[model samples]
Target: MPLLPTPSYTTSLLLSNGHVQTLYPPLFRKVAILDAERVRIATHDDDFLDLDFLPATAEAACPNADGVRARPLVIISHGLEGHSRRKYVRGMAACMNAAGWDVCAWNFRGCSGETNRALRMYHSGVTDDLHTVISYCAERGYARIALAGFSMGGNQILKYLGEHPAAVHPAIVAAATFSVPCDLVGAAKVLDRPSNSIYMRYFMRSLKEKMRKKKELHPELNIEGLDDMKTFAEFDNQFTAPIHGFRDAMDYWQRCGCGQFLSALRVPALLVNAKNDPFLSPTCYPVYTARASEFLHLEMPVTGGHVGFIRNHEDGCYWSDLRAVEFLRQHL
Candidate 1:
């Protein structure tokens, strides 16, 4: 299998560094207002995933009056601790909807504005929930389906595509992922850096809060040292690993990292990783593997940080969102 040419991605000169590019958009950019229709889908294990559907504009709607014109559908999976309503998620949904594609932005368990019934929370590698979401779309008779994921969600989608190469749904034509940390262990180490302490603090606050609530609901579950934990690695070791059945954080990262699965992807997929992204390690680039695989397209820009790919101050459109829609449209 021959490699696909590396795609080009231009970043804003003003948002020069990784942190500025990454933090600026979510904090300062104007959010797209969406009238989302929320739907709760029950999982096989009795837990539920909350999904928000945004239909295309009237001009972009299906040609058929019955709404069956082989309309393309895009399923977006948010990053860790991120819900469907996040500004980036809404921005992407709005762009796709305006381009004649129906968007389904689904939230991971315990992230849909409510605590999940089960003791387990979503992890970087968990793909069963994603499978369930895709299955739901498949059963609905969608003619073309594409996937777009951010950060941890990107890892899950890539892992799902690689793990189930032979079982991929016929309707799922392509995928696009942004700021993915393909190497889980490396990502944890990067996040533990002293300079990244602010990010770690922000994330831990949400994570610990969720755990505090989880402990309250499931008293029978053994989760000690929740208060003393400081780093992400520590929290994963204490809770994310054992509660989800891994021996420890290292074990979970080794077994679940998506880098090990990229070579097996059978569907066309675009992976965009900014070289300056604060959350990624060198291994996350996967340049060699992408060059050898027929289906994978790797795009590494010099500046876009984390999930931030803001093009410029004047035009608020994110480079990732536009590129994702463009790539998916090519396959459609």
Candidate 2:
């Protein structure tokens, strides 16, 4: 459980601090154009998950004498209010595809550019949907499957692995996560700060919009004053917690935070967090837990704000994307 050396992640001197390191790339990085086969997988509760499959590039694809495609698969779960089409998701998918791997970037409910049928939306701790996605991949006979998630998605992946360590599919060899908010209660406090208000505003706008749409679709559900809720904690207290069966925002965070469950994970997992990330609290570092667990590896870079891990101005590629692929390849 000893802490591994900080992975080789160098933040651009030009992009100083956590916010710049986190926001610059998403705002200016060249868009990654991908040709993906979109598949809608049905869930047990009759809802659905939208999955975008990017097959390995021809140069990277491995085929047998019978022309059967054989490549490792990487399942990517995006952050809050993010979908498979987001720039970072596509960028990482493209990287994995170029490295001789099939990439499936699956969207959480209500995130895939379509309204989800269920009244309940996805939360940081939700794992049943992840289980469904993994089952789909397992049934397809993938020889090696790795999982990667960003921010809130990272929290879900860790929670899933920890909560159901014994239930992981045999093909799921490893997992990687970036900029995870391991401590949800602490993260809420961070997001509530004035310095991080930009992010809070953006997220609240999206959440309110989604709630408005949900109210329209299900008029019977009471979502009154959703528009007035200004902060993440308030929004979650009014909607997310009750809809998902938690008592309130704090209760939801307490029950769902990944920090409490990391010790139970059995998979070879790599978790990367930045000391300067605006979204995390000190408790999110998980230093002691990582040092005590044989299966978990923690990488704490000095600066990589949120999900941003840009190395330099010369190369637009993300450090987290490359490192995630490398970590998963080790187990593959």
Candidate 3:
């Protein structure tokens, strides 16, 4: 199938209240974006803190007119092996901040190259940490909260909303997830395809290195048989599943998969995905499940290349970040 055509972005959106409103300019696309500066908020010693919170500082170029405290909080979640410093994350943060929202990008456990100290590593369905982050925001009196996640982070956000619909605090008004892996097992198969093996190798190398680092801290971590494991399934079965307390990769996929969670999501959500994403096959697309949810708005763009939606042409303008901002503006 040909890739989904890229959509044009406009500033105006029609809201449910029968009013058309203009969103802030997409300053994030213009700015060079910022490098991540880390801040350590809490230690794992506290009951709520399992890993140190390394919140990335915003570029400050897109300050909200409503003042920092009054704006809605936009929480960004990065994909596997990615940190808050990624250019896309920074771009998204800048867009949200420009749109009168305070933005914070979260670094998953051990993702910022810091050892988590805990035996368990972060997984796609790990929503407790996200909940804690939301609580931190709520306590600071940010009455409105929204989320945007890339890839694995996307999977986590959808799962989080579904798993804790009733328990989610009132502050979280809506969310947007991009390039999500709706079916992990099916996605694993896609990654194993000849066309996508390069991506598979890249991800597995990072994952294996993390495991190797973990093995260094604890000699008896039992990673002896994983040297030849090339597939995502093999890696997850050996490391991700066992360490995270799941029975196996299939069990993890079955429980953590986000496709089944669409029906339960009450908040307005924009799920943007790429049909050509290397991590997922055609079967991995959750079109049917997404269509079932009145609250879910799905956008499957043709390109993007597994969150690599730089959207720049041979010369001049690009539109991925702008489109993302526009989608959020329309929904939230």
Candidate 4:
């Protein structure tokens, strides 16, 4: 892909206390490093379902006891069938918290074992809930906000950042994503592989259980037809697309995919994935771009499995935690 052009000096905003700069050295200059002292904080459940939001203390050095000023906030979003407590999310949250940042691991609509009340479901590229959370922070006067997501959540973050661009809340300084499925169709095809059956089955079980509960709550909606359907495609077609207003599964994936939207991104965003991530097929990796855009960068590593950047596999000192916080520190 063509290298993105560097951003020119633009209007700058300076906050009091010599903190907060609108521009920074290029993202490439920030080396991925690791940190410790990540602390686990409080967790809360969203209003709808057992969906829990784990808001951890990313940087205890800065406190929010007064609800006024604190360290910048980094919202963590998990991948499909994952939760805020996942090792990756927790690790990253703690790492950033140790570095003086507040962190919250957002549980997607119904991923935390609780069913959302609304008929509309969560999907790649849906930004309503994310926008809601960011606006909540902005309204509270948080000067800086950052986002980090993995796998499917990565896709959602990328789409939101790219689509909103100039419209995004000014507090959002930077965003980073890992194992993002830029092309949903490509990912779906890859997940259909025989080796991926285990992963697919696990997601399918969680999804069907949620649907069964929804059916129980609203007995009028006949969902018995879903009993025979197996694949993620069929499940999405029967439930996700129709409820979310998509014409079909293919349409949903196309509209929700992040690949076509990167050129519009305005925030400093980092996209990272390993060549071995199980979710991506060879065709899904971004192609060389002819136009250099300053808004986005792609960091493709040779290892890092699907959302599994197991830090220092040998010494047990993985680098994900540090990479996450450093990315935030660079832009926020």
Which candidate has the highest TM-score of all? 2
Position 121, candidate 1: lDDT: 86
**How displaced is residue 1 in candidate 3, in Å?**
24
TM-score of 3: 0.81
Estimate the TM-score for candidate 4.
0.79
Model 1: per-residue Cα lDDT at residue 269: 96
Q: Distance from true position, residue 26, model 1, in Å? A: 1.6
- Per-residue lDDT for 1-332 in model 2, tens only? 74778766775577858999878877887865888889999999889899988888764344466544478889999999999998889888877876778988999999998999999899999999998998897666566789999998999999999987888777788899999999999999988899988998999999888988998888987777776888988888888898999999999999999999899989988999988999999999999998899988999988888888875534445788788888888887
Better by lDDT, candidate 4 or 1: 1
Compute the lDDT of residue 212 as modeled in candidate 4: 88
Highest lDDT model number: 2
Put down candidate 4 lDDT per residue, 1-332, tens digits, no spaces: 33433312122232111111101211111323333322222223334422222333434434466755556778888888777766667667766665777666667776665666666667886786777767765655577889988888888888888877777877889987888889898899988888677677878888888888888666776587776766879988888888889899999988999888888888888777666677787655664531366767777665556765543333322355566666678787
lDDT of 3 by residue, 13-90 (tens): 221111111011122234454444355445343422322222223433233455345456678898878877666677
**Which of the two, 1 or 3, has more lDDT?**
1
Off by over 4 Å in 2: 58-69, 312-316
lDDT of 3 at 213: 89
lDDT of each: 0.86, 0.86, 0.67, 0.67
